[model samples]
Target: MDNSLAELDARVSGCRACPRLVDWREEVARTKRAAFADWTYWGRPVPGFGPPDASLLVIGLAPAAHGGNRTGRMFTGDRSGDVLYAALHEVGLASQPTSLSVDDGLTLYGVRVTSPVHCAPPDNKPTPWERDTCRPWLVTELKLLRPTLRAVVVLGAFGWQAALPAFAEAGWTVPRPRPAFSHGARIALESPTNNPLELFGCFHVSQRNTFTRRLTPEMLRNVLRTAAEAAGLPTRPYAG
Candidate 1:
């Protein structure tokens, strides 16, 4: 498969590879959250929502059941998206700070947001088998993006664990002794065909982290800004 972004997206969104995930996502959509009862949910897998030539890729764990599964976009209609996009906007990567819907006019300048698992998993977790089954999609995405992809920002430990191998499969040299996942953790890898790819780790933007101050707005913004600048993206005009 050529695996162009469009091809990958269409293929990914239609996948029924994991029966457990399929059942859970559709069930949630059918039952519907009380807050989003009237909403028509997106029970299928969600695709990456960003430009095709993005230089920075953001990998999250998976769609929040009612969040992406309902809104048909990564991190949309949720508090986590609230924190993440606000940081992107602060750093000038996003045109707006909020992503309420798929067509809400929020745009990323040079960044792409995706996940290891496309479907919302039961209990916010996907089994190892499910992740492996979905790995090829991510591998294809990295292969297509590597020419311009300078950095990858991992939202949580699951993404950190999931991404390193996919990147290696795409021919990036991950360190032999894997680096631990911590806020601000960074590793520079030599890509076989492109410039070195940098890896960054950050605590997930879950409400628990933000409300408890484990991941503050400033901290998230600083890491994203630093990574974007390192990726050789144009500086935001008038950033004081």
Candidate 2:
């Protein structure tokens, strides 16, 4: 097992374990989106973004074909990111409200953002096989984060499902008959060999949810504030 997050991330970024994901990501990169025609796509797997010692971790489903796959940074250059980052900023977990590019000067404070499937999938849905194949990366990441990690906010059911097993593998004992996912759900987990951790669920920041008000900015900020507090991190009051 890699002892450092940097080494684990380097290995993750170059992974080609899932051929379907590999082909799809590369194809999208080559056939660049019209709006991002001048951009050089970071077609490889998108690694987690934030400091290694983060106490709070936010897990998403996967990278968007034109978002992370284009920018090489998870959640960057996408509508989902706009909602997520803005909420994080409002809750004082992020330094800024925007995440346009990797160099956009946006920094996550005491939080890290990652996804189960690093590469972008076709139609924004990764296959079960691909998610399983990509599981070890998350497991390793969780283990690497064990020292200071305390709370996790899983966005959407897919991420919620993916995260539980990884948490188990990383030393947190998941309850029997695994917990069902629901927005605003919070579960406390204990580990004999590791620190106790809290898990939270929220609706994804996808456009469908945001446009319909299924996940309003205030709703997202509520979850972040609760999670950040649970993780022992201080959060600023919502400026708005």
Candidate 3:
């Protein structure tokens, strides 16, 4: 992580603003999944990971209860992560296709992954109020990344919805009428002093979607490659 990102990560990790989230995340950690009974869970908020100077940002929904909550990293230790990281690897954004743990030696070249709600919510859904409360962190993080942040690939409608407001809060000129989210949704937000920020939408990489083929690796990788290219990154993504 970059120095500024490290500072933000530290603060995000220690956040306990939402009492309900705090209680629930800790309770899940305490219970421990049967398969991960011997593993120590990262019950606290999972901070966003990636370099601060990244040009592309990947915003997800919250961490998975057993996946990220267990592995202490976004999209790690879960079926969803398996699909996501594989697509990222194929697109040349990630160093490896597997992100099973925080120390897994996986590095993102020009992308950062984060979320609207940092904590793992019950039923994988965070209440609207909770979403609003956590908006400041996203807004601040965006402020820091404004220099190089060029594109944002939102994993789902939830991420799309959450990000629009943060961009507006960070003083970007948002479109008057918000664009609706779709599998291949795309929009551009203009900034007064910085380059325009492109936003792309894709279905969430959840088991519900992947298992049913609602979201395939091809679909996700296409969007990722497009976003990476739009950000001026190399486009020679591997087929692996």
- When summed lDDT is taken over every stretch of 10 residues in candidate 2, the lowest stretch is 162-171
Lowest summed-lDDT stretch of 10 residues in model 3? Answer: 231-240
* lDDT digits (tens) for residues 1-240 of candidate 3: 234878888898999999999999999999988999999999989988888899999999999999888888988999988998888888888899999999989999988999999999999989999999999889988888988999989988888899899999887888878888999988888987867898899999998999999998899999999999889888654546
CA lDDT of each prediction against the hidden true structure? 0.91, 0.94, 0.90
Error of 2 at 166 (Å): 0.8
Q: What is the TM-score of each candidate against the true structure?
A: 0.96, 0.99, 0.96
RMSD in Å for all candidates: 1.4, 0.7, 1.8
CA shift of 123, model 2, Å = 0.9
Q: Answer with 1 or 3, whichever has the higher lDDT.
A: 1
| Model 1, position 2: C-alpha lDDT score | 51
**lDDT (10s digit) by residue, model 2, range 56-144:** 99999999999999998989999999999988988888999999999989988999999999999998898888998999999999988
Best candidate per TM-score, number?
Answer: 2
